[model samples]
Target chain A: MTETNQAIQLNQVNYSITGELILKNITHSFPTGKITTLVGPSGAGKTTLFRLCNGLISRDSGEIFINGKSIDDYDPLVLRQTVGIALQSATMISGSIFDNLALPLTLKGEQLSEEDANKLLELVGLEKSLLYRNSKDLSGGQLQKVSIARTLVNEPSILLLDEITSSLDRVSQQDIEKLIKRINENYGTTIIWITHNLKQAYTIGDYTVVMMDGEVIESGPSDLLHNPKTNRTKKFVRGEIE
Target chain B: MNFLTLSLSLVFVFIPIVLSKVLKLELEKDTIIATVRSVVQLLAVGYVLKFVFDSENMIYILLMIILMIVAATHNARKKGTSIKGITWKLVVTFITIEVVTQTILLGFGIIPPTAQYLIPISGMMIGNSMVLSILFLNRFTAEIESNQDAIELILSLGGTPKQAIHTQLVNSIKASTIPTIESQKTIGLVQLPGMMSGQIIAGADPVQAVLFQLLILFLLLTTAVVSSALLGFLSYPSLFNERKQLLKKITTSTSDTEKS
Candidate 1:
């Protein structure tokens, strides 16, 4: 892809821990303003890649570019602000839901007015009344919504999701998927989502990237990935392999 | 007190050792070791204080204060070695606590600026601060381990290291200081503090001893708050890297690592 077409580009990315190659010789580009689903087996290094993109951890050997600029060019906190992430289980600070929603601005020594905070809650498909409620009082689904709204408070151009809906009920999972699509459409955000659910990956993502055994096996349009050309990809799609 | 009278005090230690032996509690060895160590250490400190007081030298006073700080830091930093540079952070905190408390005491003539006056008071402040530091570190590290995801969540959303660790840091500070605050509330009604009891036993006026004890209690209040805050602020930055990510659990603290 052309540099301008990519929101993030990784060149020969290599990462290891304790002599185990978690990610090896990876080169990929995530297209601008599009949702890319990263599907892989349990040990495929999807979370590690997300950590690298957000500058939470350094890669062993690689050059990563965001918006055609080196990730190293941006300050770490600034880079994180540009690329937000939500974990599978939402962990809230000890405060009201509004405080959690307003945290991004609060960290910057600014305040998130009630109206703006409520707008964020509404955007995430949660009621504004939850603003004054103790964040810990929410259910798994509500907490995940608050987590997404909190990430949106940063207004990141890129959002990395780490199996956020995997543990939720089917209804909550669908709700999250719809919310993610809405977020992509309304903000034009570049999203890199990781999922173990093959069907969900093939359907929800605009582009699908398949990974297995620490390597990208194939990538293409989601429709094409459903019936991939490569035998490895074909095997993965048919649930014949992890 | 005479050496014979001090030696007689060893009987009080025997009661615990005897009880442990009868109950098969297996605490006799530890109790004996603690008794021996305390007796030796206090006697050594007493003789050293006697010489320093007679010399009336400022350098000697400074050395004694430094010695106290070194001992306190060594004990306290063991609890927080997972915190990067915990040794130096502890040293700075003890020094700050000493300076702040002594400045108020001497600068206002609350206490005479003599080795006799300075060394013992510095010892009490540094000793209390060291205990407070240990409590804070224990609680703070536990908070970090349990709430690591919360800290990372905040960091992922553009929070700085300070912002990320703020909740754990504040909570730990409050937890550590609570013991001191609660004990102070029931000071004389519940228990006569050791210092006041000691002063009265030394033939000091009852009212005068209580006043001195109150002064020490007030100094401890400062020690509790200052030690926790200073150590908390200093230790937090080291927990995160320049990338603003929380570093792995501090490896140097074997006990904390094992607990986790």
Candidate 2:
């Protein structure tokens, strides 16, 4: 909410593909060192917004600022390094799990120390011995956890997660939520999470933003799920409408 | 062999056509068409080669080489119809391979600058590079489509475009080059190649024919590696734009999006 505490800011951001507009005139800001959960129905542009935030896809028009600097001013690679993103499905590099985890550092010609690698493994709820195991042998939960660990290797300031827990079992989902909360609380990492599950969003988010048809419907405190300001948010949060 | 003996080889074509008719394979027309086309095409080429050899003009030789490269580019571009600028990309790749191979051969005095030597060897080089270009394009586009998220993930992690498609590029290069490697490994024991057998049938020494065939095979191996790597680099930038953003075509490309 305050200028100094803002981690990411979007001013009238718009994007499209093949003449079909995706995100339209979006304006919002995420506070640093807090969790902002994005809740919306399918095709509401949550994923596209995440891609824009990290420079995976450029915006058609409008400006994005990261930590008070225009995104285009920084090198695209440096901006991405500062803002890490993890997708729903985990795709491992063809190597041991350790290699996949260390890739972020490896691309910069840096190697992860054995101690740091094992520490990340334990942080993500995997055993250190799994480092040497082939990534192909990992289960879905294990792979997702490893993916999160991989994103964290660079110590990004802002982390964007796009429905990473949707495909996992309840236990794995809870484990991921806990890990995310721990990261925010302990490391002061700014987190933006997109999720369809209202309960999960209410449980972990310090702030919540609801979107519909490429436009933001309502954005406020976590209690916005229970005490929505608008009729569209009411219908969405009450499960009366998709 | 005389014209009569070569004409008798139509019996081989009849054998396949008759079998297809009897087995209800429905390939008789295709077999007949292939035989007729090859007969017409080879005879035309034979006369053209004889005329070109008689002239011995450098212009004619270069024209023939350019024609071969253009034909090869057209054929190879079919495999990557979804890629933007694919036709020109194949043109660049094929021309580079032809020029490089010819420069090496002539620059080193390995082969004389005569139509007889230049035409056949350039044909082999262009043909081999064409196949390699096609193989690389097919594998590269498929890899880009299937592993799109992985590539975007790498980009989001601060990796460059080269770093993003590194795995797919390597895999494609390896896949395209393996055929050349495996065939060369068993060249002598498993099969007698076309040029060597043609020479032997024409009464050339066995050792001399083998040596020429070896030279062709070596040139083919070099073209295979160079074409795959060159095409991979040329085609990958289309997957991402100048802003380092992954284009929509990375996942699924339509004819509509094939234009830059």
Candidate 3:
């Protein structure tokens, strides 16, 4: 948890499944207390890299370190608890909203009280009255908010978002963006946002990294939108090309 | 025993198949193929059974029962390859049930080791056990794979792996055994059972055949429940490693393509 420890570190990571390389030998560090957005075109290995960090998928070679410790050193259960993730397809289980939000905590053997559940609901801009509703009945945007609240229930050190707002309307998308900014600013949670939208990335990201065909093409502060260093980055920002 | 009646019965086997096709659902081919295979295989066994009944050799009856158990085990193993050491597990389970049931029947002097008692009773038990094991194993494996994330999430939150998979495991066993229970309950009321009808056709008194069928059905209920429960409990541990992490390699799904 030191400044040099880095919230997440990928070192020469190369991942392949069945002879097809999905992620090349790419090295990067997600520094603590900052939001890093991984922007790339379709099939650019963004989700694969996120899964590797969360320990959902294994890497064929190289190592990933979180908080100065190699991924192999930590148990998978511990890694999941420390690094929470929300899938692009925000799925809610067959349960009430309270049960959905309290799932991580309940599994951890912490008895979930009504007050704590209400507080978590309020954090996501959801009213306390909605806690007892069926999770499947929630709107798309509401489900994503509940999913984020569930991810935060255990207070993970790093939160990995994989196009969480891609399926939402503009207003819902903005609501999620504001929520993400609040979570990062108030809780000091290291955020790794993966998206194809340049505008959203420019709005929320502190450090923006552009990936294309499994390689990092360019990376800099969010101000790079004003003066992009790479032609690919500029074209992508202007919607001239994918 | 007329050819016309037997031909008519063949048409009856198509009821479930035709219904499924008209509904335009999946599993139509599997159902048809399974039904056809069962008919052909059982017809061959029926011929062999006629010969065995005439000979009335105890060794022949015992061998036939053993063969049925072996076939049942093989079928169950094919469905649950994810459960490690499945061959041995199947053998242990079927053998335990066969020995226990055979002993109880023989002790009561129901029909001695004659073909009359051995073939039909063992056939009913073996067939029921096979169906039960297939249902239990398939459901168990599918449930585990589908709910893997939820299970892992629970484990990370402090639930033991056994505790995490408890609901799914129980649900699988319950689902597998419920049909047998339901059929047993509705036996003489809703439908005339196969064994009872067969017995009455072979010149046994109706009441006596009903009693025998009832006993066999009760034994089947016990055997199916016990075997399914045993299979689920014993096979579940093989899906996880010593450190309690799920082993992804142990999947019952045979296809190489990964499901999203």
Give the candidate number with the greatest lDDT: 2
Cα lDDT tens digits for candidate 2, B1-260: 67899889878998998899999999999998888899899899999999999999999988998899889988988899777898888888888888898899999999998999999998999899998888888888888887876787789899999999999899999999999999999987999998999999999999999989988998998999999998888888887787787777656642132111
Candidates' TM-scores?
0.93, 0.94, 0.80
lDDT of candidates 1 onward, in order: 0.86, 0.88, 0.80
Q: Report the interface RMSD that candidate 1 achieves against the true structure, in angstroms.
A: 5.6
Ranking by DockQ: 2, 1, 3
| Candidate 1 vs 3: which has more lDDT | 1
lDDT of 3: 0.80
Query: Which candidate number would show the highest DockQ if scored against the true structure?
Result: 2
lDDT by residue (A124-174, candidate 1, tens digit) is 888877889998789999998888888888889999998888889999999
The candidate with the higher DockQ, 1 or 3, is 1
Clashing pairs in 2: none
- The single-chain TM-score for chain B of candidate 2 is 0.94
Regions of model 1 farther than 4 Å from truth: A229-235, A240-242, B249-260
Lowest summed lDDT across 10 adjacent residues in model 1 chain A is found at A15-24
Name the runs in model 2 displaced over 4 angstroms: A1-4, B1-3, B253-260
Per-candidate iRMS values, in order, are 5.6, 5.5, 4.4
